[model samples]
Each structure stands twice: as C-alpha cells, then as structure tokens.
Target: MARCVLQRLLLLVITMTLPMMTMAGEVSVAVASNFTAPMKVIAQAFERDTGHKAILSFGATGQFYAQIKNGAPFTVLLAADDETPARLEREGVAVLGTRFTYATGKVVLWSKKADLVDAKGEILKTGKFDKLALANPKLAPYGAAAIQVLEKMNLTKQLGPKLVEASNIGQTFQFVSSGNAALGFVALSQVFENGKLKEGSGWVVPSNLYSPIKQDAVLLTSGKANGAAQALLQYLRSDKAKAIIVSFGYDL
Candidate 1:
C-alpha cells in the first residue's frame, strides 16, 4: 500500500511540472552583422534567465529590412542604424514607439598585420596597398561611415579602383582576417574587447570623420503576438545585457 501511494505522488508531481515546462517559448530575432558577437552572449543569457529561446539571424541591416518587407517571420530587429528601425515603425511593420537605441558603434580601419595600419589611417592617402576592403555602402551603415571617413581624408578618388566591397560588416572583417585584402574597414566591436584590440592593428576613426552609428532595436508586427519576443526586448535593456554590450567595445 505504501509503494502504491509513493508512485501516485510521483506521477502527480510529474504531471504538474509538464505544463510549466511548456510555458517557455522561442523568439526569432534579426540582428545586425556588426552585433553578432554581443548578441550571441546576450541570447545565451536570455535563455538561461527566462527559460526562453532566442533564434538569431545576423546580416546587414539593409538586407534585414528587405527580408522583413518580403514577409520574413522575424519577431524582433536589432538594426545597425537607428534609421532602419524608425523607418520600420513608420511603415507599420514595427510597433510604434517600440524602437529604442541600443548602442553606438565605432568604425576602424584594421589590418591583420600588426604594423600595416597607422594610428592616423594615413595609408589611405599613400594608396600603397593593393586592395582596401569595406562593406557595401548601400547595404551597411558601417560601410557608409567608412566612405564618409575616406571622403573626409580626400582619398575617395585615389582609392576608388583599389576598393573591395563586401555585402556586410562581418564579411568585410573576414576579408582582412583572411589576408585577401591588405587592410579593411570594420566595426570596432569585431576586433576589440575590454577597450583593446584582440588581434591585429587598427585605427579607431575619429567621430568627426563620419556620422554617428546609433544602433537600435524594435519589436516587429510579426512578433506582436509572441510574449517571448517582448520579453527578449525588455531583457536587452536590462543591466546584465548592457554590461555585455559594453564589454564588447560598444558605447551605450
């Protein structure tokens, strides 16, 4: 009789726990390529803390905008520029007033060789390198900032032929990492952490050389019905997430 009672109590506990386990849901997020590393850290923490899962897709903000318009089922957008999220809000694709600036990014002219890039980025004027890599300006905000820096230094015309453009900031970083390009422009976050470069040498471009790269995040219409999506966005603004972002060399 005691054995029968114990078995009945164990079954009751298991049945009660099943409903709570199913409460955890998944959220799909579209993230900017520049934020890949930081987002990976944030996503893991979000899942651990809330028992929810985050499905991340990383690419250029421009490409994400196109995909969202074409009915991609994204629950949230973490864009490389504030403008992209603002536009989505105006177009009724994202929830109004749901947009918020997440981080401000810095651009850098980087090279894998320790001595290839100078502090002032004067190599652009010398035009000695065979190829200079940058993201496609039309598709990446970081690429646009890179162009602005070149134009400010009067090297645009001189370096035009030597330019190698990638589809996004992540690919632009890869070009230099693989040594296919002598040097390239990349997000500071890609090669930096704890206020220092992880590898290679780079010139942190002056703020005066280009416009601010204010990144933003927003909840999308497709995600409005998903509670997990809203929770993820809220978690991104929490102190824990902010610490991770700062650790990755981004400005809040």
Candidate 2:
C-alpha cells in the first residue's frame, strides 16, 4: 500500500507542475471595437514576450457594459472611452485603482476612393453619393464625433437623415469597406496600419469637432487574482507597446 501511494503522489506532482513549467494560460479580454487594430499589435508583442495569448472580444463599449453586467467571463477591458471603465469600477465590476487611460482615439471620414473626398472637406458638396455611415453615437465614441462634425459644419440638418448607423466602429468601417455606404466615420486607425494608411483615402476629422476619446483599461475583479491579468495590464503600458500604439494612429 505504501509503494502504491508513493507512485500516485509523484504522478499528481508532475501533472500540476508540468503546465506551470511550460505554458501560460490565455487571458480573456473584452476590448472596445475602436481599439481593435492597436490591440492586435499589443497582443502580438505580449505573446512573444510571455508566451501567453490574449483572447479578445471586440464590440461597442455599451454592449461590453451590458455583458459585464450580466456576468460575462472576461478578465480585462480596454474601452473606447474613460466612462465605461469608470462606471465598471463604481459598480464593483472592476478592480479599483487598476483602471487607467491607455490611448486617445481619433475619428475620420473615409472613402474607398481619393476622388470621392476633397481635402477642403467638401465631399458633401461633391454630390456623387447619398449614404453616409457612422457608428451609433449611443454605442460608439467615433459615431458621436461624426455627429459633432456635422453639427459644427451646420450640415447635420441636411445629412442627418442620410446617416447609416453601425452598432460599433468595426461595423462602421465594414459598411464603407464593403461599399454598403459611400462614405463613413471610423477610427483613424482603421485605414492605417503601423503608422501608414493601409487602404482607401480619408479626411481626418478636426480635433475641434468633438471631445477627446480617452480610452481606458481595467482588470476585471473576476480576474483580480490572476498573475496573467496584471501582466497584461503592465505589458500594455510598456514603452515597446506604446510604440505600436502610436503607430496605429493613437496617442499614449
């Protein structure tokens, strides 16, 4: 009986230590739709350094708020604006003191073709198209910027009815990329990659058009005890990570 017991104990010890010795379990994240491109850069770098994978769910801040409220299994959140993480902390959904701004987002009016827009920002006067797409302001920060730009130019009265609403920035870009809408408001980073434009042409919306998009991050209380979760938060703020973020049309 003693011999059998000794063998069983050895087997259990190896089973427990084997995973810890060689692998990092993936961390799950709920990232704001607008931050998708930059997050990809951040994730790739993090994985190379730590051997841990980030499983990301991209969507609107409002929808993420709803999911976390209903007990979604997410370890971290990178929001499109500061309000969501602030609210999550207030509601006891995220770890207090773990929330901070990660990036500032920018919005742009983009077209699949250069001729479709004018540098003077007079695409509206061109009159070659009818539909304009933007994220739903209620759900997305960039969407709200699109509305502000229209209001600033006093074109909201004429363009309001022609607006096509996307549930999130990803969908907003998709609408234009697929030609479902002639032009759309999307994150400046969407058409850009590694500090260069990847597809199409765009007019960067003026900063005066809307409030700054202060994106935030937090460690969900559900994953408070996780070493990997904290590691991810730290990784995102590292100098190397910041370089990639800046490349994606965001400011640290």
Candidate 3:
C-alpha cells in the first residue's frame, strides 16, 4: 500500500508541473550583419520574456535578398537598408503591409588603433596606411555609403589601389580589428559602446555624405501562418528592444 501511494504522489506532482511549462516556438530570422550583436541581445530577452525562441542568420542584406528569393527558409528579414525589404514586398515574397523601419544606422571611418583616424577623417587624404578596408559596394549599403563619402572627397581614384574590399560590413570590421587593414568603414553600431566608440578612433560620417541608411524589417510569406514570427516582429518594436538598439548606437 505504501509503495503504491508513493508512486501515485510522484505522478500527481509530475502532472501538476507539466501545465506550468510553456511550449516555446522558434522563429527563423535573417539579420543584417550590422544588426548581429544587438539582435543576439534582443533574442535572448525575447525568449526570456515571451517563451519564444528566435533563430538568427547574419549576413549582408543583399546576399540575404538573393537567398530569400532562391527559397531560403527564413521567416523574418532584418535588412540593413529599407530598399531591399521594400523590393521584397514588391516582389510579393514578403507579406504586404508588414514592412517597417526598425533602425537607422550610420557609417563610420574607423581604426582599431587609437589616434590612427583623426576626428575629421584626414587619414584618408593623408594615405598613411598601406591598405584601407571597406565592404563590397555592390553588396553592402554601408559600402555604398563609403563610396559616396570617398567620391564627395574626391578620394576614390587616389585610394582605389590601396583598398581592401570585404564581402560585407562585418568582414570589413574584421579587417581593421584583426590588423590586416589599417582602417575601415564599418557601421557605427559595430565600434560603439555606451554612445561612444569603444577603443578605437572613428569619424562618424555625416549623413549628407550618403543616402540615409534606414534599416527595415519585414515578415516573409513563409511566416504568414507563424504565430511566433508575428510576435517576434511586434516585440522588435517594443520599448525594450528600442532601448537596446539605441544603446548599440543605432537610431530609432
């Protein structure tokens, strides 16, 4: 009788505890490389607060656009530029009326070594370094912006031979960070901490130097029926997420 009573008590405890466990769902997101660090922080908080998980894949927005078109199984896209998401919406690959600007990013002329980049970005004209890094202009919005800045200063031809091009902004940052290149153009969010550049010297490029980088996010047709996808999209616009984005040097 005692053994049977103990077994019944254990079963009752297990049954009562099961109802309190939340059934979490996953949402796959294609995130722009510039947004990677902030997205990691946001994903953790989202799962903690809502019991929903976000699976993130980070890369250049242009590459992501091609991947999505080729039938990559991504439910949400956090693009580095507004145009790509808009194009996807126009192409009918993304859900209509689901696109929104999530953040605005700035490009910066950055050097991992302190004092290498002057406040006015005079280092470019001086050409003190053997190699200057930048992303591939054809694939990254930041890279295009860097090109515009170079053009505005008439440094394109002068710096062309000395340039080291990476496929994406993240790789451009790596070039500078790893000391392979003396300096590079990277997203402000990459080198900033607590509203300032972390350990390096950088010049925050003027917005007038290039087109506005209005980063946007959209839900793909694949996510149309996914509750977790919709919820994650909504959560991105929440006050908490906004606070995190701003802290990472992105604009609302």
Candidate 4:
C-alpha cells in the first residue's frame, strides 16, 4: 500500500510538470478558425527565429471569448471580427490599446467538384443536393456573411430551411470536403491554404456580395510586452507572413 501511494504521487507530479515544461518560452494563442492557415505559417516562422513555441487553438470567435472570460490562459487572440476584441478590452479582460485589425477575409462557395454552383447563387434554392453547409451564423462571422448574401438576394426565406450548420468555418469546410454535405460556404483561405483549388471548384463570392470580413487581433491581459507575445504580433505583420496570407487566398 505504501509503495503504491508513493508511485501515485510521483505520477501526479510528473503530469503536472509536463504542461509547465511545454509552456516554457511559449505563447498561448486563441486564434479564430478563419485565420488558422496563415497563423500556422507565421507561428512556424516565429518559432524558427525566436526559439519559442506557440500553442494555438482554432475556433469560433464567440467560443474563444467565452473561454477567455472563464480564464482560459490565452496570451493572444486573433478574432474574425473587431467587435469581440474591443469588447474584451472594454470588459477589462484584454489589454487596452493593443487591438488592431490584422487581415481582411474573403468568402467562397466551394465543392469537391467543379461547376457545382450556378451564376445566380440559386443552388440552395434549387435544393438539388443532399446538403448545403455553412457555419452557425451566431458563432462565426463568415456564417453571418453567408446569411447577409442570402438576405440581400431575398432568398433567405426560400433557402433557409436547406442549410446544414457546422459549429465553425473549418467544420463547415470539412462538411463539404467529407461529402457529408454537397457544398459549403467557407472562408476562401481554408480552401486556398493548400495552394489554389487543385481539387475543388469554388465560387469566389464577389466583394460586393457581403460585408468585408475585417479580422482583428489583440493582446490578452495574460500577455504583456513579453518577448514571446510582442514577437508573435510583430511577426504576423512581417512581409513574409503577408506573402503567406495572400497565398492562402485572403486579401491584404
């Protein structure tokens, strides 16, 4: 019994230390799903130059806000919109004067095969397929854009019922990728991250179709002018990172 108790305590100590060890010289990032591809590229570059690691989590802006409110220990947040980051600062949870728009996102209707979408954007109304996927508009900005485009076309009432909802933009893209849904409304970046539409055919939603997706980033209260956080932010604005961003189909 005594030996077993000792071993158990030793295991507990090891488990607790593991996280601390991984976190040493590392920054915690709560990145919105829309920006994952470029963020990953920038994080890799930052790690190479500074000898520090970035632990990143990608999700909807609303979810990350909730987690930060609950003290999730994220040092930085790259949000799909500016409002949430501003709200966090107002709530005294994020660092004031450290928030700014990072990138502008584009939306697209994508499918695994070509010619799936028509010029009229009436694919949803036609109801010619098993499913049409989009992120939950309440949780994701791109989802909201999809709704806006539908409403502007006066097709919301007609096409609303045919929508299949995903929890985030990434999952919405996956629904189309896995053939769980016929096609999806997703950030153009996710579909373009792998270097153009090699397999899938996509409709690049016109700039006039919906509101511009001006994504923003902020330093959290958990971050200061620390070497890691500052470096990461600076690295994000570098020319190298910007090149990667454009390569992923996002407008600068």
Q: Candidate 3, residues 215-247: lDDT per residue as tens digits?
A: 999999999998789989999999999999999
Please write out the lDDT profile of model 4 over residues 40-72, one tens digit for every residue. Answer: 888888787766789999999999999999999
lDDT of 4 at 50: 64
| Candidate of highest lDDT | 1
Candidate 3 Cα outliers beyond 4 Å, as residue runs? 1-23
Error (Å) of candidate 3 at residue 151 is 0.6
TM-score of each: 0.93, 0.89, 0.92, 0.86
> Which candidate achieves the best TM-score against the true structure?
1
How many steric overlaps are in each model, in order?
0, 0, 0, 0
Estimate the lDDT of model 2.
Answer: 0.87
Candidate 4 whole-model C-alpha lDDT, 0 to 1: 0.85
lDDT of each: 0.94, 0.87, 0.93, 0.85
Residue pairs of candidate 4 with colliding backbone atoms: none
Q: Order candidates by lDDT, high to low.
A: 1, 3, 2, 4
In candidate 3, where is summed lDDT lowest over 10 consecutive residues?
Answer: 16-25
lDDT by residue (tens digit), candidate 2, 78-164: 999899899999999999999999899888888887668666678865546778999989988788888888888888878877889
Q: How close is candidate 3 to the true structure, as a TM-score?
A: 0.92
Give candidate 3's whole-model lDDT.
0.93
